[model samples]
Target: MSIAPARIDEQTIRALPKAEVHVHLEGTFSLIDLLTLAKENGVALPGPAATLFDISTHTDFETPEVTTGGGTGTGSAGLSGFLRFLDWQCGLVRTPEQAARVAYAFAARQSASGVRYSDVIVNPTHWNAWRGRDLALMDALSAGFDEAEQDGLCRVGIAYSLLRGQTAADAEDAVARLADASLRRVVALSVDGDEKTTGRTGEKFQNAFAIAASAGLHRTVHAGESSGPEGVWDAIDLLQAERIDHGVRAIEDDALIARLIADGVSLGVCPRSNITLGIYDGWASHPLPRLLAAGVRVTLNTDDPAPMGTSLEADWAVAADQFGFSHDDMVGFARRSLEASFADDDLKRDLLTELEAVVTASTAAEVTA
Candidate 1:
């Protein structure tokens, strides 16, 4: 029997109100935005940033070693290409002002994409060292958050991220900075970086998690993306994350799946990021459907709009097309996202009501026409 294709209109899907739970602040930079920022900041582009945005450019798989340590190392060639791309990105974002500019532009672009609310991950450790001023880095990022919220384009929140390579002292310092109630925009603390750099050992950043939890901040950790389902367990057992980012691999273990369902933990599911990183061969083979069907609370997001060439709408389409999700399923995903969001109860209820109206109107239009 032939499989049915997912029926979703790109334009209509773009109009859907959605909450993005796993987007990275720096990762949202579009190729056009990156180029403009580079020129405005007097930074040089390695090549044309625009070319990376071209969907037609087939990655050269033969020359695997041309690039260094980036991309989806699923194949030798893809890994090399990713590394080269990372080098290009690193070259462009060198100062605090550049980071702020990227943040402002990213919010504008995401606003245009119809995202009503978003919680973006920000890692200041690497950028701080890059700019050689810890206080300056925080101030610049805080400014970006203030500007985005004031514009009323979207309700923005920050997840102050801890790098995997940081020492215990580094984590302590990060927590201390976040403990300051003056930074009211920061809603949570997260761990993000090379997963291998910080495993389940819990020695490096355990104190950081404790600090965040004590400060009444939400906790999220990146696991099971590069590692397997065990990484998911480690995050919960060690870091005590209320949510797991890219926890798709949790499907590998039955007990783990049961725990996730019973505990009501949220998974920040990024379908395009998985396919681009070779976690799943393609969207058709991704485990999002299985997880959702199994009663796991899954929310959609764009890990990086520019790097992975995806948006929140594109992610919903992938779910519909690849997983055979119905219109109700799409609405359910949106509701799940809002429920899992860090937004206050009042805002959450309001967004859910608005989303219900959107679903109703779309369904009514389809039925009438």
Candidate 2:
């Protein structure tokens, strides 16, 4: 008789070892943080801070009109409205100290979900205050996360994002700026923003990605989220992304799916966000299961946890419940997350060791029973 691995239940999710690779700093602010920052910054509010992101209860994202004026996130549905909210929310952090607070909060929040490390993407275009002082902004964030490290919580790596519509010159400038030694926490160069609205921009930033590759920085591109399979192809071909964010749409093309597996490019998938933003009708229709079935290297993430109202562990549970993910599947996804992250080799090894301990303990317990 063959012995099975320890069974994974919902509670096991909290004990699972994982890392988050696609979370955005702008959209991860907690409601309490938003309230505190609004009070400290004297930002004008449309209503009470408690109900700021509670404006919508629906899940369809058919609207093309961008949210305008003082509307509290959810004025319109889909990616455009979410981008506008990110702009408004990020603007609340007018000082370096506030940015530090946001970074610290990231460690604390991910810790609760048992995430060992997170590679956070922060698009500079969303901020107005630190428009010219890029290094200073990162310095502040690094300081905050460093403080959290003392507590032994989740470690963080910063990835600066280039908005899709930005010119190639802007991409060049971003890569050049990121190369500075003072920006200590930056590990990867990323491209974010809505691909549908910005259209095809892989060619525009191709040179910048090439520069980043030479400079020893990792490349992550946001593709197949708002756009289709063609966008994903550009990421793999032109930009040569090490990982693709929100790549659910890659399922639309069979060749694209094969390419992702052949090229060993991981996709950071956010199932809850996809449904909440109406990217799909519901969880059943999500291509995540299909992608996994096709042997794609996919990892679950909370793209914007606070804004989308989901957590890393919660996403795992949902996947387990909806997709019939077994003990091995969840464990394998956790392993994939660690392998796919930009974390240093030492940290990755240490975390992987801890993961094995969790598994071994569970196995021993089962044997004793």
Q: Could you give candidate 1's per-residue lDDT for residues 1-369 as a string of tens digits?
A: 988644975566667677888987756667776677567757665554557654235443222223222212233444445544544454466667776766677677777777777778876543423543544665666677568778887777788777666778978886887686447668888877645434454556778898888998889888777677887887787788899888888989999999999889989988888887678899778888899889999998877667776778877886787777777777777788888888777888988889889888877997999
Candidate number achieving the greatest lDDT relative to the actual structure: 2
Q: Rate the local accuracy (lDDT) of all candidates.
A: 0.71, 0.80
TM-score of 1: 0.86
Against the hidden true structure, what lDDT does model 1 obtain? 0.71
- Model 1's C-alpha root-mean-square deviation from the true structure amounts to 4.5
lDDT of 2 by residue, 1-369 (tens): 978544455578879888999888887888888778878977765445666776343232222232221101122354444665666677788787898888999999999888999999977777767777777888889989998888888999998887776789977987887775636798898887666556788999999999888888999988887678898999989997999988889999999999999999999998887778677889999999899999999999888878767788888888888887887788888899999999999999988898889988977997999
* Candidate 2 local distance difference test against the native: 0.80
Per-model RMSD to reference: 4.5, 4.5
- Model 2: runs farther than 4 Å from truth? 1-10, 55-78
Angstrom error of the Cα, residue 357, model 1: value is 2.4
